[model samples]
Target: MDTLSALISHAEPKANLFFSGNLCGSSSSTDHPAGGILHLVRTGEMLLFEEYGLTHRITEPTLIIYPKGKAHRLQPQTLDGCDVVCANLTFKDSPLYRALPDAIVLPLNELDNLSDTINMLFIEAFTSRFAQVAIISTLLDLLLLLVLRHLVENRICQEGVLSALSDHKLSKAIEIIHKQIDYPWSIDELANKVGMSRARFAALFNQTIGQPPLSYVTEARLLLAKKLLLKGEPIKSVSLEVGYSGSVAFSRAFQRQFGITPRAWYLKQH
Candidate 1:
């Protein structure tokens, strides 16, 4: 994959990873929730199926990303009890996840070694505040690393220009955009960072990501602006925080992105 697409997965100003697990359930259980699910069965097995046929049989380290909030099960072959470690997770609403499929399973790859990092999420969710949120926060980082490795190692879908975001150069640009959300950026700079010419970067980035480099930069910045605004920053401050030369430019961009003016958005907050 290209750089930018790869970079998007790691892009932060991301959602808090609120759950992880060391759960082992041998009994069949059904779940229907807005939250998504991921499962890894080490010993026995798991069957993930809907009303009719089978969706998946988990005998290995199976990774499922359920987006439709559909009903599914986790258990052994007989539709009865089985051993499984499952994770129920949710993320703060963000634009990036909009690109993922409702569900996909990938090989565990090399990420299994980092299982402890993932296990900590379960600890954080169920445990008291004895340690610190920092531990859970770090777990999220590592969890992201695993998901990223899985997505990269085994990409199921083969559609959409956005999938090209998995490309290396483009992913690099995305990472830069995310890491430096507060800095004003130019396509030329992003292009250079990814070792491409301005025109080349624009065309390739646009083709793969379904948006031009400028739009992406603006989108990334405005997303950050909204986050800052949500944190109670003033309009002018939010504008500057996201790299606008002035609040007016930022306002226009923000309106273009979210369908309302910054002042209106801020007022709604108060």
Candidate 2:
């Protein structure tokens, strides 16, 4: 897969719709974490105040995503009509998170491409009919994908994994590393694959990705190892699968990276 697809594959993002209701008076929401908060305004209007004292007025049929999870307050404009659906989004930790903004607001006009999905979400949320939960959950997932796509297409994310993928040379190198995590990758090999001199490639890769190329390879390997361990694979098997020759070497490297031996980490997770 390409770099963007590979990064997204590792992220394993998911969305959960937790609350849906109407508010008549002013109120504030509880502080959330970096995982993200999504708000779909179905009717009336509300004001969102950020921690920095900035405020945004959201009218009906608008979607707002707070990717940074800043603490904020939401108050209705009046005492009669503000309906909303709120959801929490969770995704695997990655540097890509840094590329996103504090919040992304898509008004009704901007959502023309997603009109059908947005409409379906509102319908499923308000009707509470058969399979409403499943339908809403699916729609929320679609909405999250839409938002990420918008960010990429608009070039709104200028750093982190997304930015690296936007570069031709770095993306090719990244794709190779992701596709061949088990291969013993050297800086020379990665640079050669991308048709660049080793020094030039190393410098550019570090500048674009904020880390050395081999460091990314190691991270990718460890991520794969973690997945294998979680699936009950043997330590030795995971070691070789991720390029380490033996369990002892793998255990040491894993411990250095995560501050715990693989076995201990697996047991705690289980």
Candidate 3:
């Protein structure tokens, strides 16, 4: 499977439309939200006020993304205000979310690759159409993917899984691991697969991914197992699917990682 597909499997993203219209006033801090906030400015001008007195005067069509919910304000600069589309971005708790920077602000022209998609989103937002909400939501999802692709290709993320995925050799190792999560993988084996010395691979993986290689494997397995268990799969089945030998071993590791037994966690969810 492609690296992005595999990565998305672990960090599936969802976007929900919250606002779309001409804005005449400033927005309050959005620190209370659960996920990230995305704003697409279609016209006019505005001022972005983020924490720590960080400010930007936005004069053109722009895309503003907050990967984590943060306290920020958006104020209109022009008397007529700006035409904007906004969405709430939610991602599964995974490396993708953890590795992202606090915020990304760029002109819409900078993402010319997404011009068609952006145009469609703007048109749909302002015009009456059938299934407009669903269409806009789907387009926002696509926009998220394209933005992530831009980050990866430009090596914008300085560290963590996205950074690792940007590295030619490390990405290969990650791809294989995601493809075969149930396989018992050793560090030496992964290093060899990626044609790197085991020692060098271990160090580089830690440097790029911010953790030991095997630790990541265990975390990946447990995270996947957690999702499976939540889907009502039996613990034993989830265990084996995530590479554990038995439910006992899986439960023990799960407890170690999560501070609770699988049964308890499952019960709490329900």
Candidate 4:
């Protein structure tokens, strides 16, 4: 059988599911599509963690997600039977999922634990025999949001500057920087704002996030600048808002990251 299998019971004119089926394998070979995986533990438990790496498990009465596309193991944790419902989803051109980090996990021991709306999606798909693609698509969106929310609430991120923002001191510091991208934020001052000694705060943040605090803020500001520029906002406006003195600095940063000038990107994007 293929790595992925989907069947919609209903075929409505306005499709409700993009694709639905089972995704299982003897092993997590590279054969699976490079996308997200949503899995529900139907019976026995599954231990899904990696050694000295990023991983989480799906015990009974649990819901687990593989957002970063990480390779992990799954099998019956008990003898009852390891039944699972798995979905391999891809949100091509969806900005929301694109903005998310690699992986997120949520726990659900009961079917009712999931959003009622989301559960209804499967119910309709399984019960109906028409085009349910529309419903499934929307349900998948909610699923993606919940997955990201899991990461956000837990503050576990495999990608994005949010990794740095996960720090309490740095999160606060980053908040201030975001609020005042126009203001020059010093690491010493930010540390003081968060009630940590400059040396201690900097060290802790660097150790936790693998980058200098100031660099983190700079990159975040540049990202904000890019967002604004993408919206066709004036370069000067973006620079001033993101803490740059003017368009020159912001444009330079944008160019450095995209290998294209902000204006060029804006024109092409628009």
In candidate 2, which residue pairs clash?
none
Q: After superposition, which runs of candidate 4 have C-alpha atoms over 4 Å from their true positions?
A: 1-17, 21-118, 128-139, 152-167, 257-259, 266-270
* Residue-wise C-alpha lDDT for candidate 1, range 158-269, written one tens digit per residue: 4333365457787677767767767767877888899999999898877766778777777767766766777787888877777888889989988989899987987887
Provide the overall lDDT of each model, using Cα atoms, as 2-decimal numbers. Answer: 0.61, 0.79, 0.88, 0.56
Best by lDDT: 3
Query: Would you give me the overall lDDT of model 3?
Result: 0.88
lDDT of 2 by residue, 10-56 (tens): 66667898778896765544644345788888898788887877478
Question: Candidate 3's residue-wise lDDT over 35-134, tens digit each?
Answer: 7899999999888987776478999999998877777889998789899998888877666777888889889888889899999999999998999988
Residue 114 in candidate 1, Cα distance off native in Å: 4.2
Which residues of candidate 1, in runs, are more than 4 Å off? 1-33, 50-53, 67-76, 93-96, 107-141, 153-168, 182-184, 263-270
- Top-TM-score structure, candidate number: 3
Pick by TM-score: 2 or 4, better one: 2
Q: Candidate 1: minimum summed lDDT over ten consecutive residues — where?
A: 10-19
Evaluate model 3: give its TM-score.
0.94
lDDT of 4 by residue, 92-199 (tens): 222233335555455553334355755665565456556566556666566555544445545666544345445566567656655565678898888888899999
Better candidate number, 1 or 4, judged by TM-score: 1
Q: Cα deviation of 123 in candidate 4 (Å)?
A: 2.5
